[model samples]
Target chain A: MNNQKIAVIDHKCANLHSVIKALEIFKIDVKICTSKTELKDIDGIILPGVGSFDPAMKNLIKQDLVDSIKNLTFSGTPLLGICLGMQLLMENSEEGSLNGIGLINGTAKMIESNEEDIKIPHMGWNNIEINDNNNSRILNGIKNNDYFYFVHSYKCIPTNNSEVAAFTKYGQKICAVIEKNNVFATQFHPEKSGIVGLKIYQNFLSFIEIGK
Target chain B: MIINKGNILLTKRIIPCLDIDKGRVVKGTSFLSLKDAGDPRELSNFYNNQGADELVFLDITASSEHRNIILDVVEKVSSEVFIPLTVGGGIRNLDDIRNLLNSGADKVSINTSAIENPDIIRKSSEEFGSQCIVVAIDAKRNNNSWSVFTHGGRVLTELDAIEWAEKVNSLGAGELLITSMDEDGQQKGYDIDLLKSIQKKVNIPIIASGGAGNLKHMLEALTIGKSDAVLAASIFHYGKYSIKEVKDYLNSENVPIRLI
Candidate 1:
């Protein structure tokens, strides 16, 4: 596990420092990758992002990393997306005009609530209910209805419900975690979610270990 | 388990604020008369361990010479603490926001700069996501209404508190950290009227700060005040209450608190 290298895609969004710091606690080698060459022979890939959809996609396109990510995932490299990174896995998003990475069958839509109490950004700690039948590896030790920190305005809606590993209720059933083949994504920042969130990274590392 | 009748519960946050002076954490009464608290990294780690939803570090150093001191503190603290960290005080432009974010701060709060150049809010939010840009408004009640203050509440601006909140919301700020000057350090309670007025004007989450002396005050700010989060300093800094104790109190009150 110490020798296994994990590449964190830096799309010039907000700081990728926390994500890297979180992974480092597991004693695995982590590298910040901006171009295709940096993705070579990596054991795992982490797509962490913050900010708008169009500019993030544009940053990936400018670095010519769109196809590299798709091809890597096509070959079954475990890829995990966080927040906007999760939204980018969908075909498109209503927040912007650009197309997504198209790794999953879904779209990112704005979370609207008629109830005055429910906020738009959903910025706080919220509990999640794991999909009983999905048997997601990332949520292996995570219990049902455990709280995790979240900060976002948009929610990911997967076309296939089976792909959703977990869901959290805000105003409606919002997709909190998705697992499809080699790709896994979460709508919350695990790095900032404290201990339970660290357990998630631990599970992801175990998944990578099994793959090896 | 505040609303456990088959309803989704997004718990309200309880943030511990540390006002940094020089390098150590400090607390002041209504933004004056500073007193030393503890080390930033140690206190931050303690709060994170005690189940603080988030932490805010306000650099209260008066001189420009010690401005870089907070950045070093942020860098050291962010490496150890995993929860979301927000740093405010002396942020001037996008570069300052970028510098703090790069130094591992999850959010950067701008007060005086946002007033000096309102466009800074829009530009910084556009450059970085609105989620990472927090606009801190220090407001003081003036007779029938409230006015926004800047420079650690030492300078007054003609901007109406509610109007400024609406403007910042439109300008793309993700959250507003409103500190009440009148109730600050008084330990009576938060400015409930001030929070309610701003909450009505903007859809963004508001963090109520100042005048947190007891548990009921914190509950009142979250319930009657309608704030998404409550930021307190002296109570926690002086060891009057623990974050767990406050959360337990709120949880017992059915406030949907996150209990670790």
Candidate 2:
């Protein structure tokens, strides 16, 4: 596991320090990839994002990484997206006018609540209800309902229901975790979610090892 | 544990605030008369281990000359601690917000600057997502109403507390950290009336700050005050109660808190 290299893509829209720090806790080799050249020979790729959708997509295009990342996944390299990174995996978002990476068939929509008590940003710790049939390796030891830290205004809506691994309720049944072939993403910040969140990173690493 | 029951139940956060001055954590009464607490990194680690949902570090003396000192503290603590960290004090513009966020601060709280230039909240939030911009409002009782204070509570503004809460929310602040000057350091309890009024107007989460002397005070801040989170310094910094003790108390009362 120590010899395996994991590349975290830097699109100028996120603070990659925490993600790198989280991955380093397991003694794994982590690198920040800005362009396609830095992504060569990587065992796994992590796309961590913050900020808006259009700017995130624009940053990927500005770095000339869109094609490289898309091609890398086509070759069966495992990819994991976090927060805005998860939304970038969808086809597009209502927050902005840019097209997403199209890795998953879905659209990102604004989370609205008619009740005044329910906030819009949906910030704080909330538990997830794992899909009973979800045997995804990324959720290996995670329980059915465990709290994880979340801070976002938009929720991902994958077109295929089977692709969703977990869901959390706010005003509606928002997708919290999604697992498709060679791709896994979470709408919450696992790096800031504490021990249970650390378990998620551990499970992702173990999945990478098995793929090798 | 809060049963899902097909509903999203977000646990009310119990946060330990560390007021940093000259690179050391300090606590004070009504934003004056400071006393040393401990090292920022040590206390942050202590809180994280005790299952604190989040942490807030306010640089009480956030002068231009001492800016780098707080950045250094944020860098060191964020490297070791995993939970969300919010750093406030002397945040003047977008560059200040960017610098803190780049240094690993999950959120940046601005009070004086936001009052000085209300546009900063909108600009900063637009540049770096609303989830990272937290507006800290210092309120003092003015007869039957509350007036907003800035500059460590030394300067008072003409803006009304309740109205300012709604204005900041419209300006794109992700959360509000409201510190009541009247009840701060008094140890009786949070200013329930102040929190209740602000919580009613804003859609963003409100963190009740100041005047937390015991566990029940913290509970009142969450339940009656309707704050999404509670921020206390003296109680936690002085060892009056550990975070676990408070969580255990709130848990028994069924407040839906995160218990490790």
Candidate 3:
């Protein structure tokens, strides 16, 4: 089946089911590529993640796929990250002493509230206010303040606010979506999200608009 | 408390319980091969515009790393749909309920959190009012007893879901989002037995979830299952039956429903 190949980067510790399911709901072609060997010449790459930052980074390193991912991103190949995938695009993650992919300079830290009563995991559905004034193709099908499903405790705080394409509130203000050229990341899962999340994939598919 | 957006209460709510990961909705058969159901924002717009009464967004993603719903996504959808959205999964405390409501969610549902900290229900109800607190209980038949599963049906808790429903009601929960894990996605129909049992035990409105394939199932849920409302993902997600179609069928079947 030679479909539009979208890889749920098999970086050892990743949630491939929901991402693959989202692509399937859109009827787009998707595959689970656990290794760089299977990700040659793909239409686009979807790097998804869950769980801890240190273990996730360790798994990515153990598989020796980080360099390939960087190469792919540098080559201008379209790539997207969800949740931990989004955090990996940052410069460093304070959750674990590991530096991130550094694709975008940002810091990911725990959700802290001076209110003295906010929970840590900050679970549940919340509204995502779109920030990209340019309204790039990724946000084409979505509108400002459309709620998407989110599940994360720590979130990336982009130092460069310009790179913040979207933002969400969790105790303190946190980065929701980050975009710079071919690289884009959403702290929320478009795959597991409802129709709004599907629109993100549809937009991404349209955003790439080309096969590798 | 009084209601406005949720006041008239939807008679035929085309509610979709989204299975979210990362932050998107995921639907699958038997909890596998999850597909892009659609963007939550776009889908919410379509549903809200499509004459839907309400929306239910479930953060189906496991919170092993303490994941929370993306507020931007919620704000975006709430701003567009202008409809009440009931959000659930990994809700731990009253603060979570406050955050969700502040982020534009109309109602917040609790599962394992209620079990781990039952006091939260009382606290949340007192702070946010019972109307804003929804208790979602996932029960599966086990050796002649129904058991509640938490953490996205990954962990089977010791609490008897049916009894827990009554307990939560006593704890001041306003509603119940009860699902039969055995019937979820099977499409045979809503779990009549499960709903019937819980309906007898709990006084609050019960939104029966799982095992709905067609309108007949919905009618059965209302007439026989005696559910206050019926919720399904597959039948509605695949577009096999539009919300209007289901309502029409339900009406024909003599089930009282809010018709446009």
Q: What is the C-alpha local distance difference test score of each model?
A: 0.90, 0.90, 0.73
Which parts of model 1 have CA positions greater than 4 angstroms off?
B1-9
Per-residue lDDT tens digits for candidate 2, residues B17-48, read 99999899999887778899999999999999
TM-score (C-alpha, index-matched) for candidate 1: 0.97
Output the lDDT of residue A96, model 2: 91
Off by over 4 Å in 3: A1-212, B1-12, B63-69
Query: For candidate 3, lDDT tens digit of each residue in A63-149?
Result: 777888889889888889888899988888888998788888878988775652243444334556678563555777677666655
Check candidate 1 and list the clashing pairs.
none
lDDT at residue A98 of model 2 (Cα atoms):
90
Candidate 2, superposed: residue stretches over 4 Å from native: B1-8
Clashing pairs in 2: none
Error of 3 at B134 (Å): 0.5
Candidate 1: tens digits of C-alpha lDDT, residues A47-119: 9988888899999998899999999999989999999999999999999999999999989999987888777
Q: lDDT tens string, model 3, B28-132?
A: 875656898888888777766554656888877665464655555666676555445788877877777767775767678898888888999998876655666
Between candidates 2 and 3, the one scoring higher on TM-score is 2
Per-residue alpha-carbon lDDT of candidate 1 for residues B135-228, written as tens digits (9 for 90 to 100): 9999999997899998888899999999999999999999999999999999999999999999989988999998999999999998888888
Could you say which candidate leads in DockQ? 2
